[model samples]
Target: MEALIPTPADCEVRSVIKIFNAQSIVPIEIHRQLCRVYGPNVMSKQMVCRWCRQFSAGRQSVHDEKRNGQPSIITDDLVELVREHIMENHRVTIAELSSHVPQISCSLLHEIVMEHLLFRKLCARWVPKQLTPEHKTNAGIVFLHDNARPHTAQRTASLLQEFSWEVFNHPPYSPDLAPSDFHLFLHLKKFLSGERQHFENDREAEMVVTQWFQSQAADFYDTGIQKLVPRYDKCLNFGWDYVEK
Candidate 1:
């Protein structure tokens, strides 16, 4: 038989209180002992004192008493409503959702969006917990390239036009304004530095780079892309001169 590893119980704090109270230790001393073992965050001082009082009053059970009021109800309809709101506006905040669905509490609405719907806030938008292959393929591509011979070639322009991609004009000799130069390469360079050895071939190098890109959170690309607006503004402010960092 495999050995069973003991996991910390949900009522561990209360159990500790019960044990120490039986030993006639004061609440403050009990709290100090708990802090020494479990750190201060395990339970607050006020909670320790409250539990100590409960034990003194002949309360044998460490389990919480059943309350009289109604529990917070989370319906399927409420979950659907939250989903609709999010789909309508991906950048909708929890507070905005609350205004749309005033019946549910903000906390409950958040639970519906995150736990039930499996969506997380990324780049100021509620995105899926995992990006599907379809999601990646469907994402809009905003192409930006410098005025190199190959990039500025007629064939390249024709290909971009065929794909219907919106190309941002890259000012000549302004690598500072390029997101790949200023942001992406800086991080990519650091990542390459930590490699164990040089890649065997171009294929291996491409695989490694693709894996690194996929491993990054959805917000990573968004952050790099969003920097362009501010960078352009700064570049214009500086009269098209090299925009200092």
Candidate 2:
């Protein structure tokens, strides 16, 4: 298994130890090594060296020392009160709730609702309960894809019917308007275009593709489907004519 990158706290602690123990390893060297391993966006050299200086002066713990501040007013009672307000009216806005819970700030109240109560409001309403894996499989997933022979096999059709999912078919021969053809496969092909290595076997190719797909940001997949909306509208405008890329 790949070792997990040290958390910011752990890295700070480790940097301190490296400073005193090694006595010659510099902050820039440490920063360069960390960036190469973990990517270039981790903590700065200044922070690492600052911690090193503190530790060299005999500071021990890696954990942050407490600073003087007004203690947060939010308590268990306030959290419960916020929960009650949300439960009483699922449609209640955070601004409106702030008026009732004058002690808590709107940001704090929002955090309590989201983090503490584990509730999310969408479009002025509480989000629907999340579906279980079984629910998701049985709740009729609308599968839209290229009409490959395997996908259109009698067994596949029967399975879809049993699961109550309806397959939406695009107009015949309009591959440009087919969401999978125009969006998914197109992007996948482009992504693979820059690769120079040739896979020795199907398993190797599958592993490479799986890793590449997993590395993609969530927005990348969402954007693939989002791109279909305009194509669909254009197809409709052209009276189901073949839409251009």
Please list the C-alpha lDDT of all candidates, in the order they appear. Answer: 0.73, 0.64
Candidate 1: give the clashing pairs: none
Regions of model 1 farther than 4 Å from truth: 1-141
TM-score of each: 0.41, 0.41
Tell me which residue pairs clash in candidate 2.
none
Error of 1 at 244 (Å): 4.5
> How well does candidate 2 match the true structure in TM-score terms?
0.41
Kindly state the number of residue pairs that clash in model 1.
0
User: Candidate 1's residue-wise lDDT over 94-169, tens digit each?
Assistant: 9999999998789988888888778876436676665544345544555888788998999999999999985766
Q: After superposition, how far is residue 172 of candidate 2 from its true place, in Å?
A: 2.1
